[model samples]
Target: MQSLIQQYFPNVLLLKQEFINSTIETLYMVFWTAIIAGILGTLLGVILVATGPEGILKNSVLYNILEKIINICRSIPFIIMLALIQPITRFLTGTTIGTTAALVPLVIGVIPFFARQIENALLEVDPGVIEAAESMGTSPLGIIFRVYLVEGLPSIIRVSSVTIINLIGLTAMAGAIGAGGLGNLAITRGYNRFQTDVTIVATLIILVLVFASQFISNTLIKKTSH
Candidate 1:
């Protein structure tokens, strides 16, 4: 067993601790980014939904403004966004490197993505359900929380799963700026070092993470569906 590992997966054995640490860093970045962005994105999405021309709180100006902001952010490619936002990242994290600093770009990059997903998800809620709630004299806030959100839960989970998968991929790119994750290992230690084993191992682990996240999300969606 040991011989086979050393032969087929030498780098895995050689950099055992690195693989573990990088995986942890990757998870750390993903978890925190998702939480922070999830809240902000969901809020923006809800507001966009509530204030749209057809929304309960109907405000074309607010909706168009918010929509334009989200679209602008989404238009910028992630890599440039990383370099472009270096000043802000440094100001916020006091450095433009490492897992913590990486969160700045990661969150900013993902908010628009997640917000759009959330908006689409919430939009899937039937207009009649909203009307029924309004007829009952429910406040817009109450209708949003109880009717739109509840009905949209399954779709929200589905979109959230896709967003998280995208976030995982983004974390790898974050490594280009020294964010310290499997991507860092893959690039610096694997590709740069000319060690195919490290690169392969890093990719395999990232795939596992993506698949696991999708599985968990599917499960939640199933349970949440009415």
Candidate 2:
């Protein structure tokens, strides 16, 4: 059994330990980055919606400033943002070359992107629902929480799925800077070493992770939605 396995899956067997470690590292980066980006982006998104011209808060100055900031950050490519923020990353993580360092860029890169997504999701909430809440004398905070967030839950889940998948791709780019993960494993051990099998296996694992995320997200959306 061992001999047969080894014959067909030599590369997988050879890099089994690396494959496990890198997969775990990628999960670690994705989980934490998602949490941080999720919270900040949600806040920024809500603010963007609340401060729009027709928003409950209706502060154009604040809205424009935040919108510009989000736009500028989102405009920069992830790879360049990773390099451009090296100094900040080093200061925060004490090293700009590992999985921890990678989180800095990963979170920064996704925050604006997720914020825009969340804003769009919230915007999709029905205006009549918001008006009903307002007529009931609901405060702005109440309307935002009970109306926008609740009504948009399904859309938010869908957008979150998309954001997470994008973050996974960004993590691959992070591997270029020694952020050891499937991406690093695929590139450094597989491609650079000419180990085609290793690359294929790594790519397959990433695909599995992505599909799993999408499935879970879709399930949650279905459960939450009417």
Candidate 3:
């Protein structure tokens, strides 16, 4: 068993601990960034939905401002955003390198993208449902939670899966800057060192993460949908 294992994926088997640590680092960045950005992005999205010109509570000023901001931030490429936001990252994390620092840009970078996703998901809710809720004198907050959130949950899960997959890819880019994740391992040791096996292993792990997230999202969507 060991000999066959050694025969294939030799670098990964040899650098087992590095691979393990790098994977953990990758998960850590993705986990925290997703959580933080998820909440903020959701809020941004909810506000956008609630305040848009066609929203139940229209506030063009707020909606337009938030829309422009989301566009500006989302327009910036993640790599350049990493460099562009370094000062802020340094201020937030007290340094601009490693897994912790990478998180700042990760969350900031994904927030706009996720916010747009959330807005789109919520917008998919039937306008008639919201109008009916308004007829019943259901408060704006009530409709948002009961109608928009409840009806849009399946879509939310789907978008979340997409966002997470994109985030995982971003983490790999983050690894390029000494964030020390699977990307770093793949780049510094695998690609840089011409070790194809290690690169394949890292790529495989990323694929697993994406597929697993998509599967879970699909299951939830099925269950959540009527």
Candidate 4:
């Protein structure tokens, strides 16, 4: 296998192992980060909507605090957040480098991003449906689950697709800190070494992944939506 690659694609063959490892690392980082972020973000977003001025459980104090916290966190740049949260990341993952360490910042950085997306998606649900549910004596929790989440499913899918694509880009930046992935491979072995072919290949792979994600998400949205 190695011999054949080397014979046919000598330039990339030398970094074939690194390519595979980096791809796996990126997938690992993105997958775990997305899971954690998706859960937290969904919860937080639902809370934001449910506690807003017109929400089922509106509370000025709680809504203000949560909104401010999300806004503050989202305001920080991802790269800066990566550097700013080094100590916390180290505490969580026991190191400030590698895929594991990168997960901390990735999850933290993406939570607010996806939270806002989820919030918007939920907001897009027709207010009349929610009112009708309430008029029928549906519990707050039931309305949230059946009305907001269910009605917002397609929009949520769309936003989730956007978030995942953004996450792919963030994973690339994570490579700057030695979080081994295609981004790191491109920078360290491709850019640093002036290997144009390597850089192009890494970029193309990322693009393919992004496109595939979009396609799947769009398909799901079309199937679920009216």
Candidate 5:
């Protein structure tokens, strides 16, 4: 294996450029998607919770509709959703390949998942606080924006960390379809050419990235909450 890697070292260097480019692409895709989805998902989560049966703004009709929609979207596997949303991807980015084009599907794919996480996190908040806010005559939206957001910031950060890590993994899978990312590099240069070292290297990099993100986010959550 050492000799084989030595023989391909120069070629691997070229492919390594592609891997780096792919990693950057994946980062780009994940960051933008997280930004959009984070904002929108938080809103959706607040809405979902606030409009539930016991919510301050409870509305069975609306909550049921939103719930079903979220479920349906979340039910679709990421890979199939990639193909399914190709037209929208083209319309959004003018192409069905590359990192930018992948954003559409990634955002759509991640939003519901994040929203669910947000909902669960917020639900973990003490109801007494919400009740206290209600006694202060806070509007439904006010309760969510001020009370829930503030009180749940730590949980939000924690869940957001998880969501981000998952998004990174999805971004890699997106590479399988023409979306350039580390996953694409692994599949193309590593798997296609049977370059196991390339695959190992990409995997190690991703693991490091995930661990680093997790550590940083957890530290932030701890510091902020305390």
Candidate 6:
């Protein structure tokens, strides 16, 4: 088995190299999308919380528009979004079949999802704390920036970690569309060729990625929550 891969697939090592490269690509997509989505979603969520009926900056106009946008975006499946945003991805990344191209859809896919999570996390913040901020003459902006954002940091990080891991999984699925990564390798090279070894390696790599992320995130959350 080893001799066959070494001789026939000189790139067997390259496959491992590809695994690492793809892992890095996946991380790049996940982190960049998460950061952008985290900020935008946090803002959207804060707006959702602060502008709901009894919210500090309640505005039926703004609230309705935000709610509808989030709902509509969330309704679209990630696979559909990949195809749906092909032109945009090409425009942004100059190609629609590699790691860079993968990011555009990944970001669009995650923002609404994370925004919803951020909304839920922020909503969990104590209303009394928000009220206190208001009572102290803190502007709505100040309340969101300081009170809500700060207090919600731990939960946001924890949720962001989950969002990122989910994005990694999504990246694998993107392989079906030619976004070369572990999934691409698994499907195109592994399954098609009957090389269960490739599939096993890819799955193990993904599991390790998830576990490592969980470990690091759990530690951070514990430290921050303290």
Best by lDDT: 1
Tens-digit lDDT string for candidate 1 (119-138): 99999999999998999999
lDDT of 3 by residue, 43-142 (tens): 9999999999789889998899999999999999999999998999999999998999999999999999999999999999999988999999999999
CA RMSD per model (angstroms):
0.7, 1.3, 1.0, 2.3, 2.2, 2.8
* lDDT measured at residue 104 in model 1 versus the true structure, 0 to 100: 98
Q: Which tens-of-lDDT digit does each residue in 14-89 have in candidate 5? A: 6767767877887898889999999999989989888988788889999999999999999999999999999998
TM-score of each: 0.98, 0.96, 0.97, 0.95, 0.93, 0.89
lDDT of 2 by residue, 97-136 (tens): 8898899999999999999999999999988988899999
lDDT of 6 by residue, 1-226 (tens): 8888776545456677777877777677667777777778777787888888877788999989988998999999899999999999989889998877887888888888888888787877888998888889998888888988889888888888888788889989997678877888888878888877777778788888889889999998998884
Flag regions of model 2 displaced more than 4 Å.
1-8
Minimum summed lDDT over a 10-residue window in model 5 is located at 7-16
Question: Each prediction's Cα lDDT score?
Answer: 0.95, 0.92, 0.93, 0.93, 0.88, 0.82
Pairwise TM-score winner, candidates 1 and 4: 1
Off by over 4 Å in 6: 1-14
Superposed model 4: Cα runs more than 4 Å off: 1-9
Which one is best on TM-score? 1
Clashes of 2: 0
| Candidate 2 lDDT | 0.92
User: Which candidate do you rate higher for lDDT, 1 or 6?
Assistant: 1
Better of 1 and 2 by TM-score: 1
**Considering lDDT, which of the candidate structures 3 and 5 is the better prediction for this target?**
3
The candidate with the higher TM-score, 1 or 5, is 1
**Candidates sorted on lDDT, descending:** 1, 3, 4, 2, 5, 6
Model 4 TM-score, all chains together: 0.95
